[model samples]
Target: MRRTQLRRWIVGAVAIAVSVLVFLVPFAFILITASKTTQGASLLGFSLPDKWVLWDNIVTVLSDRNGLLVRAFVNSIVLTVASVTIMVVLSAMVGYILSRRQSRWNGVITFFVLAGLIVPPAVVPTIWVLQRLGLFKTLPGLVLIEATFGLSFCILLFRAFVATIPRELDEAAVIDGAGPIRLFFRVVLPLLKPVIVTSIVVQSVAVFNDFANPLYFLPGDQNATVQLTLYNYAGGMAANQYNLLFADILLITIPPLIMYIFFNRQIVAGMTSGAVKG
Candidate 1:
């Protein structure tokens, strides 16, 4: 018993050490490189700068192209907030109905929702549909696209979480003359706080970091997102300003990273809570 416990403790310690290095090394490189000059950044090795210019790099990135980075930041915020809000509410409602209802159509809807996980989106067709709706090259179009693409996954998450919730509470609410909307908002949603936070954190990160959807559905410099701003700093035919690029990369990465750090516990709990019950 002592030998087995000792071995397990050793393995756990090694695993933790390895995990920290794997995640932090690259981030350390980014932070160090972002503090260097263009010439220094080009080295791209893990070395502290001769002269710390982190603030200068930040200023350059923020002030570049007459504040294009700021605009992209605003666009990303709008897209993330709108898409996440819609995804959470819609997915939760749909998941509740699907979990509670019993019918053949329920299986069909469930299949479609799960299908989103397996099937890759058709970009050209999506663009064509957006154009037909006169929503192409627009922020709202991109928001809808992000929301729709994310809906299935969110629904699946919410469905699993909802299944864990006792039906008795829902019944109790209904018996008290609470309508569906009231039952969900007053009785169900409060219990869903953990999963809701998980969904928001997960979906917000995905939507904010998404590069392809905005590129395909909402094309144009004016509609650029935070991810697109990286292109503004370094791209084909453009002189690669590695320092500025790293600075911008670090700046854009902070929000989602902070979110994950803060909500890490809720995300884990929410994902695991449904497993035992369902």
Candidate 2:
């Protein structure tokens, strides 16, 4: 008993140490650097600031270029909300259909869904399509891109979770004179709270932090997402404001961090929900 207890303690201690090193240490470095002067931040070592100027850095970053960061934040929020909403709704419906109906086309549909995850997006072709559709360099177009890229993964998650739901519920709903839409919306959707929350939280972070998609599909200072705001402090004619850059990173990082912290348990539950059953 003593030996087992000691082993458990050692394992726990190691896990804690690893977690601190991997996550907390880096976060601390970012925090410290963001609070430093430009010269101090340029050194980029993990140390406390001689004088905390975090508020000053944040103010400067927010006010830079007539408050580009503020506009970027609005763009990011809109992009994330729109794309994630589309992903959740579309993926949920597709997953439910796939779960309940096993047809000859199911295999083909699943194959394509899986391929979306496996296949690397053809950037030039995608751009050509966007241009042809007159959606090039638009926020709505980027929303579609984000939604499509995330769809496959979200579908898999929802499909697995949907399998855990019994067929009896559907039968009962149908017998109660509920139409297909009514059945799904009224009966099935409510019970999908856990997985829904999971998808929203997961995709929201992905869309909000997405840089490349917005860069390629949605250009212009007016359409800049928060991640693109990092460029305003770095490359091109931008100055060497390392402090403000780190400050921007920290600012943009907070939403996702808070999300993960609060919904940590729900994410675990949603991911593991259908594992045993399906």
Candidate 3:
């Protein structure tokens, strides 16, 4: 028994160490590159800068060619926040109905939602559809698209969580003269705390880091997002400013990274609670 436990502990420690090293290596590389100067960067040196140009690089990246980075940053914020908002509301409503109301169409609605998981997005066709709908190349349009993609998974999460909540609560609220809206807001909704937080954290991260939808749907330097900003920077800035490019990458990574670090526990708890309860 002692030998088996010892072996398990050793293996677990090794696995954890390996995982941490794997994560740290790329992060270290990015930091080294981010801190390198134009000349030092050209030499492809993989150490901290002899003279730190991080502030200079930041100022340049943000101000270069009339503040494209600033615009991109703002665009990213808008896209992420707006999409998450729409996704949360729409997904929660759909999930509530699916869980509470046993309509004949429940299975069909579920099948259609699950279909979103399997059906690969027809990017070109989707763009065409967007154009036809008069929704192309705009932030609101992009928000709707992202929300559509995110809705299914979020609905599943919410439905699963809500399934664990008792129907008696709804009945009790109704007995107390509560309307459907009041029961939802005052009674049923409050019990969905864990899953809602889970949805917010998960969807917020995804929408913030989204690359392709923004690239294909909303194409313009003026509306460039953080991920798209890198493409523009890499193509325009060239090798001499690769360090600055690295700086730009770091800038874009910070917000999501900070959010995750602070809320990681909340995310884990929320997801686990919802999944287990439902």
| Best by the lDDT measure | 2
Model 1: lowest-lDDT 10 consecutive positions: 232-241
> What would the TM-scores of all predictions be?
0.96, 0.98, 0.92
Best model number under TM-score: 2
Instruction: Report the C-alpha lDDT of model 1 over 57-158, residue by residue, as the tens digit.
Output: 999989988898899999999999999999999999999999888888998998899898889999999989999999999999999999999999889888
**Overall local distance difference test of candidate 1:** 0.91
- For model 1, name the residue pairs that clash: none
Ranking by lDDT: 2, 1, 3
lDDT by residue (tens digit), candidate 3, 112-213: 999987897889888888899999999888998999999988898888878888899889989999998888888888887777777888888898888899
Q: Each model's RMSD to truth, in Å?
A: 1.3, 1.0, 1.9
TM-score between candidate 3 and the true structure: 0.92
Give the better candidate number (2 or 3) by TM-score: 2
lDDT of each: 0.91, 0.93, 0.84
Better of 1 and 2 by TM-score: 2
Clashes of 3: 0
Cα lDDT of model 3 overall?
0.84
lDDT of 2 at 202: 93
